[model samples]
Target: MTQPIVEMKGISKSFVGNKVLNNVDFEVLPGEVHALLGENGAGKSTLMKILTGIHSRDEGEIYVKGEAVEFNNPKESEKAGIAVIHQELNIIPYLTVMENMFLGRELKYGKTGVTNTKKMKQLTKEYLQQLGIDLDPLALAGNLSVGQQQMVEIAKAISVNAEMIVMDEPTAALTDREIERLFEVVDRLREQEVGIVYISHRMEEIYRICDRVSILRDGEYIGTRDTKTVEYEEIIQMLVGRELGTLYPERDAEIGEVKMKVEGLTSDAFHDINFDLREGEILGVAGLMGAGRSEIMQSLFGYRAIESGSISIEGKPVNIKKPTDAIDAGIGFVTEDRKEQGLVLSMSVKENLSLPNLKGVSHQTVLSEKSEKELVDDLVKRLNVKMAGQNQEVRMLSGGNQQKVVIGKWLGINPKILILDEPTRGVDVGAKKEIYHIMNELTKQGVSIVMISSELPEVLGMSDRILVIHEGRIGAELKREDATQEKIMYAATGGE
Candidate 1:
């Protein structure tokens, strides 16, 4: 029998006397991609943290290659040939790719301490090429897109000579093209016999890549099964402890009159965009990576400079020069990069939610604490946000809950038009259903929506109409009944 690359038996953990994991058993073998499946707050992160020495396990036995071991810190795990590529990119935007690859461990001449930039850059170039990436080693990390930054992280892991790499929601920020590139990298790592602990909310990827699947539900060990043998519903039942039925909840809202109109909208990234969002309707925008879907929406919301455009709300023209202007125009935006644009991680939920609706929560120049509390309280309850309390730091909550905070904060203003960009990215399956339900409810109240998503299923399942953007232009307009995955792909790829 092949020795397990990493193993944990009878694993358990607690935080401030609250149990998070209970006797969970997990293991991975060489050249295997083992998926750790769970919903948000299901203890997947907790278990991985304990394995990497970020947290202490109350009970457990860990083994590396059948040798008993204990890692005191992440550095110790790295020394033991283990590395983690976190969901959050660790690249410093100002640093060059080569500099980021060798951060904190710069190569230097022996005894002289002179930095060896040439050798590091060469190594970085070679590593990036090994993964079939065309990124320039000298390029600034800050100038790269989210997907490029992610590929940089993988090159960093490979440079560490990692035998086992943990990937947490690796594709959450990626486009379909970038995801394909990532999968190719994964395949190469598997060829090198690298053990991969794949963590993600996406099921399709598991079917495509993972060899084995383990389930964790509310901190308890559910079971493990061969990925090929296990059915999708069975895995969902294990992770969520319930039959999810249909991932997309059936929509029951009616589409109505035009709520907002955009004509001849042009920006540096996107051009000649025109669309009409009807009240109580969802207008989904689908496109290839870098097709300028986000730029179009940002331009509409006054987050980006528009070269030429005409926007109207309820048939009345409005000049939106900035985010505040758009807000005043009754337009709310839940940006794609929520952590960077939507919410302040350091701030409490109450403070973050209150930032967007100060006008509604205040009286003249004097802030009204009463009104702010009412707004925050109502949103929390309405969103069913799980947290220690309203005052808890937003970063302390799970990814799903953090997303709700982003969406809920916008609701305080009672906007007529809402824009959700990659709304369910990095969120778990259960939370996704909740968000869909919320979207349905919002449309029921006559709040128009414009959803930009890479997930074809989500676009098809929720949108009343689909607009396929090809190279920054609307290539095709598809009705809900007419839109199919193949048709969207055809239009997105510039197939006229």
Candidate 2:
């Protein structure tokens, strides 16, 4: 057998007396794809950070290709042929793609110290082409879509000649087509004998791409198994340390009267949209990426302008020109991008939860801490949000907990109509089940829901009615009893 490219033994980490990882052992062979699976806060990130030199280990030993190494910083780790593509991308938005790719390692001419722009752009183009990414080298990073930005990050890693690459939720923001491209890149990298450490909550991806799987639970190593030899159920049991019976709970909410009506709704990204949401039913909006599903939700929630449309709530015509108007009309929106638009990362959990309904907990321009605390406490407990405290910064929470906080903040308003766009985008399977249960509970209370999801299974599993969007228009609508993956895809692709 070939020697392992990277090895870690007896690794442990802690923060302020809270142990995050304990006596973990991990290794990856050259050309091998190793999956690191765990629930949120299960020490996956802490362990990876120790390997990448972002955090110092409490006690551990690391070896790179039979040589002991100690890295004092990320730069040192990078120089040692280690690169990490973080879950949250690290590209500078305002810079050009080439500029961001060569950030901190610019090509320069001899003595003069002038940047060799031509050489950098040429190398950037070559790397992008090799990865099957079609992007302009001079385009602004912010102007590119999320998936494109992810590709750029991968290209940056390859440019560094990294022998071992760590990918943290690399496909969380990717589309189906983009995911295919990424798999192709992975195959090519494997042929080059590069090692990959893939960290994700997605089981399907792990099974499809990884050769071996390592399980972690509550800061301890459970076990490792060859991917082909292990059953899916066995891996799940090992990770969560229990049997998870069903991925999604059964839908039992009764459909009531129509609570929201849209006729001839048109926006820059979508046209001639029509849908009716009942009081206790989930109306799912399904589409391919850029099919205008999210745009429709944004327009309905008054975050975007509707060029032509008529909206009615409970038989009353309403003009919603802004988010405030939508809130006043008993509507709430949980946006698609939680980090950028849904929550303030720097703010406390209590602050974010009360941001939407400050007026209800304030009087004469004087805020009531008592009322705020009561409201936040009730919603947090109701959503089962795990947090250090109400005063803890929201950014410190895991992806699942952060999503719960976003949902809890919207629930504080007690709106009659709720729109959720990719509500479970970055959460784990357990958290997804919980969110679905919360939706079920909301419907039981007669709160109408409009869910936009790229995952077909999620739409088909939870929705009462499914609407397929194609090229900025509603292509088809199918009742839950009639909907199937084939029919939805056919319609979403503009099939006859």
Candidate 3:
């Protein structure tokens, strides 16, 4: 048997008085992919943080290659051959790809204290070649698409010669082809005898890539088992402590007449778009990356300048030139990029929950703290958001909880039309169910929803109608009864 590459024995940690982690044990072998499975707030992240030195364990013993070790900080962990790629890509937007990759550890000019630009470029090219990824090293990081940015992050991690990598939801924003490329990279790393600790909520991905699976429940160690020995359902039960029946609630949509219509919509990014969203119905937009699904939502939400368009709410023409206008017109947009556009990380959960509808929590045109607190508390309970309290900073919450906060913000406004762009992206299964419940409740109240999703199963399972977009135009419209994965993919690919 191969020697263990890393191990954490009896790890215990906490914040203030709360025991976030209690006697957790984790181990990973060289050249193997070890999957960390858990629900939101199950202490997966806290345990990993201890390994990477983001947080020191209150009590624990760490053994690296059968030798005792402790990381004092992230740099120390990196020096010990551990690296991390966060769910949120961490590339500097304005910097070039090569510059971002060689940020702190640049090539020096032979005993001189000056960096060598030519050597850095050459090394970057070699690294990309080694990974079988073709990218322009001089291109600005932000100018690349999300898929390309993710590849750059992987290359950066590998450039440091890391022997162990912690990947946190690496494929959350990627397409099928991008995911395949990532798997190829992982295979190469495994051949190099590098250990990878993979963290994700997608069970299919875990079984597809990992050799062993370790589960955690409520901050305690459950068990580590061979991937082939356990069924997926059993793993999910261990995570959430219950069996999930139907992912989507009952679809009792009334199918009312169109409440909002867009005709001849043209923007610099897209053109000649037309669609109608009906009251008491969920309409899904299906398309590949860069097929203009998100662009349409942004244009409709008044986040982008529209060259020409006609929008009518309730058969009455209205001008939506800004986000405030869109909100006032009963349109609430939940953007795909939650961290960048949805929530203000520095504020409390209560502040973020009340953001879209401060007026509702105000008295005599002045803010009422008591009413705001009450409203936020109610939303927290309704959404099943896991947090210490409403006063906790939004940044401190997990990815799933932050997503709930975004949905709560829009629901607080009580909009008649809701546009959800990848609403369940990067969320855990439990949070996804809660979001589906929220949608069910809203549709029952006559609110319209337009869901934009890359996950075909989610679209078919949840939407009342599906609109497939290709090259900035609608290719086909399928009723929920007639929708299928192949049909939607055919339409999304322009029937090619």
Candidate 4:
């Protein structure tokens, strides 16, 4: 049996009187991939942060290889052979791959301490080769795709010769091929006796790569079990404390007449895409990574430069050259990548809730504080955003709650046509259900919805019609009843 690489017991942490982690216990064995399963606010991130010294625990004890230690900072944790690759890539995009790998620890050759770029590149190449990863070390980090940048982070973690590595949803944005490559890398790391803590919402991945599983719910340890022995349903039951039954909500109602139409939509990022969204309908766009689903939405919303496109609202052709134009056309967009584009993390919940409704809050060129508060207060209650009050910073809220703010902000605009890109991405199961109900509510109100999602279940469950995009073109459109996994996957992968 492999030895335990790291262990924590009685781990409890609180921030500003809120108990984020409550007496959690976690463990990882050498050469094993231990999956940490939980909802977004289940204290998974907080527990990992405490382990890595991002935050000190309010009460707990940590043991590395049977030796007690307290990590005061990330650098110290790295020295102790532990590293973390977050969901958001931490690489400096402008720097070369080799430079990023050796950042803050560059090799010096002479008394003058001259940086040796060649040595760094050679070392990086060797590390990449170790994992059977082929790439140009001299290539700029920014030029690489999201998946490639993720590989760079893995290379950097390996370069440190760390004993344990924690990956937070590493394959969230990766393609099928990229995910296979990631699994291969994990196998290689395991061969090197490096324990791994894999955090992800995708159950299929846990069954594929994880050796053992640890579940946490509401900041407390639930249990750990052998992946080979436990079934997926059992694991989910342990994590969520409830049976999911059907993973997706039941669909009702039929798609109606085309309420919004796009023809000859062309942008530098994407080209020649056309689709129609119907009244009381949900049309889903499915694609692989970088297949331009988000790009199409951005072009439609007038956030990007559309070289050519004819957009029609309610069957009337109109011009939307900017966001203001889209707004005037009664279009609301909930962007993908919620952290970067969807919500203002620095602002309060009330401010973010009223973001898209600034015009409503402005009375004769002056901001109406009372109206803003009233609007947000009602939205908060309606959306069930769990916060102290409307004045709390959005960043302080959980991922699930923050998503509600984004939806509420757009709903307040009362858009006739809503474009939601990856609406439930990275949200917990409960929150996902909330978003689904909200979509149903909007459709019941005769508002048209265009949902772009990579998750096939979500696409099929929520969409009245599915439009699969491949190679910057609409490959096929299928009715919800006809949208099977095999059919959609075939279209998405450009298969006949």
Model 1 lowest lDDT segment of ten: 247-256
- lDDT: the better of candidates 1 and 4: 1
* Residue 108 in candidate 2, Cα distance off native in Å: 3.2
**lDDT, model 4, position 480:** 81
Off by over 4 Å in 1: 108-110, 115-122, 134-139
| Candidate 2 per-residue C-alpha lDDT over 1-496 given as tens digits, one digit per residue, 9 for 90 to 100 | 7898899999998899999999999999999999998888889888888888889999989999989888888998888888998888998999999999999999999778999999999999999997877888999999997878988988998899889999999888887788888889998888889999998877778989999999888999999999999998899889778888777678898898999999999978989988898999999999888888888888887889999999999999999899999999999999999999999999999999999989989987999999999999899989999988999999999888999999988899899999999999878777888899999999999999999988888999999999999999999999999999999999999994
CA deviation > 4 Å runs, candidate 2: 134-136
User: Comparing 2 and 4 by lDDT, which wins?
Assistant: 2
Residues 288-395 of candidate 1: C-alpha lDDT, one tens digit per residue: 878999999998888899999899999999999999999999999999988898899999999999998888888997889999899998999999999999899999
For model 4, residues 106-173, the per-residue Cα lDDT tens digits are 99887679998889999999998998989999999999988899889989999998999999999888
Q: Model 3 — TM-score against the truth?
A: 0.93
Q: What Cα-based lDDT does every candidate model obtain?
A: 0.92, 0.90, 0.89, 0.88
TM-score of each: 0.95, 0.95, 0.93, 0.95
lDDT of model 3 at residue 283?
97
Lowest summed-lDDT stretch of 10 residues in model 3?
232-241
Superposed model 3: Cα runs more than 4 Å off? 136-139
User: Which lDDT value does model 4 have at 93?
Assistant: 90
